[model samples]
Target: MKVIIAIDSFKGSISSSEGGAAIAEGIKRVYPDAETVVLPLADGGEGTVEALVSGSSGQLRTASVTGPLGEPVDAIYGIMGDGETAVIEVAAACGLPLVSPERRNPTLTTTRGVGELILDAMERGCRSFVIGLGGSATNDAGIGMLQALGYRFVDDSGHEVGEGGGALARIAQIDASGTRPELTSCTFRVACDVDNPLYGPDGAAYIFAPQKGADAAMVEALDQGLRQYARAAEAHLGHDIAGIPGAGAAGGLGAALVGFLRAELLSGAELVLDSLGIEAQLADAQFVITGEGRLDGQTSRGKAPLGVARLASRHGLPVIALAGSVGSEASALNSQGVSALFPILSGPMTLEAAMDPKATAAHLQGTAEQLFRLIQATAGASS
Candidate 1:
């Protein structure tokens, strides 16, 4: 039997490649002669760079860039095997994890590092970009990133506005004359999953800033700033991006990418799957195995496993999902073409113990072995 393993990272436990390896090991235990193909997968978020790089046999490049708080941080991006496509996750440069809880101020964070990463990749001859817009630590409407790309945000006095979302309200002009000339030749595909607008009750600041350490007052202030920025962007860039779906993602980085970079916002899972050439791998597979850290109702909404299941279903292949933890809403995934769902846990244990990488891999292998045993028995009985 040809079994394809395309599992996502278990998040803090095993990576996508490791998860696939564990599943393959289990399948081997049940069917020693089985042909197994382990394909690493992600949804274009935290593991995007790693997934794309490993899956495509690409190389990872690291650079020193300004962090959300203006500190220097090392950020990594990937160049595909073709050497022309670069995959970047903005979180690598300006994610919330870089800031301590007491210092996690959205009003003060910036996305400057993201621009640096892009520029670095461009300098290395990458003309196409796949940027993952998730886990941001800023609410600046991407002004800091634009600044790094040579777009100046000037106040009424013609002086450049200071960094952070708090300063966006004072912007009076956007000067793009100094922007990198190479940007016009580049094409950007943004990995985005949310549909929030740029500003207002359901917008970036109101909905996401709180998690970035914004209180009620700060949220209001940031929202006003985004509104002001939107007006300036409309007048300067001649695009109405304020109400675009997904514009609020990554603290309005989605809007900036769309308006300024002319990027196409796509479902993160679809982007990752296409980039990895998953369809080609499913052609000869009899059964597919996929999973993630958790399986829930949200899994059907463009998560990696759902994408895998949908693809497998097209080929009439049964998809078995093994999640670290299965939620009450996991049943929703059944309609999405997942033939079966199983938790990797053997029995009740402390969350910490279960999350241990070695323990998690062992659990995955044991669970998969038992599942394959049942499948084999059922097939034998039918024969």
Candidate 2:
């Protein structure tokens, strides 16, 4: 039998490659002669870079860049095997994890590092870009990133505006004359999932700023700033951007990508799957195994495993999902193409114990072995 293992990273436990290897090992235990192909997978979030890099036999390049708080941080980006495509995760530069609870101020964080990463990639001859817009720590409407790209935001006095979301309202002019000339030749595909608008009740500030440590007053202030920035951006770019779906993702970074970079926003899962050529991988596979940190109702909404299951179903291949924890709504995945769901746990254990890399791998392998045995017995009984 030909079994394809395309599992996502078990977040904080094992990477997608490790998880797929564990499943492959389990399948080997049950069907020693089985042919297994392991493919690392992600939905363009935290592990997106690692997944795409490993899956495509790419290389990772690191650079020193300005962090959300203006501190120097090391950020990593990937160049795929094609050598012309670069994958970047915005979180690497200004993610929420980079800030402590006490210092989590959305008003002060910046996305400057993201621009640095993009510039670095461009300098290396990458013309095609896959950018992940998740886990941001800023509410600056991407102005900081724009600045790094040589777009100057000037106030009424013609002085350049300061950094952070607070300064967005002070912008009176936008000067793009100094922007990198090569940027016009690049193609950007942004991985985005949310549909929040640029500003208002359902916009970036009101919906996501609180998590970045914004208070009610700060949220209001940030919303007003985004509104002002939107007006300026529309006037300068001669296009509407404030009400675009997903314009508010990553604290309006989505809007920046669309309005300034002319990027196409796509479902994160679909983008990653296309990058991996998943349909081609499923062509000859007898079975597909996929999983993630958790399997729940949300999994049906284009998560990696569900995406894999849907594609596998089209090929008439059975798909089994092995999650670290199965939630009450996991049954929802069955209607979306998952043939079976298994939790990678043996018995009662602390969350920390179950999350250990080695333990998680062992449990994943053992679970796959048992699942194969059950399938064998069922096939025999039906025959």
TM-scores, one per candidate: 0.96, 0.96
The 10-residue segment of model 1 with minimum total lDDT is 296-305
After superposition on all CA atoms, what RMSD does each candidate show versus the true structure?
1.6, 1.6
What would the TM-score be for candidate 1 when compared with the true structure?
0.96
Error of 1 at 121 (Å): 0.5
Give Cα-based local distance difference scores for all models. Answer: 0.94, 0.93
Highest lDDT among the candidates is held by which one? 1
The deviation in Å at residue 290 for candidate 2 is: 0.8
Q: 56, model 1: CA deviation in Å?
A: 1.0
In the range 106-162, model 2's lDDT, one tens digit per residue, is 989999999999999999999999999989999999999989999999999999989
Candidate 1 regions with alpha-carbon error over 4 angstroms: none
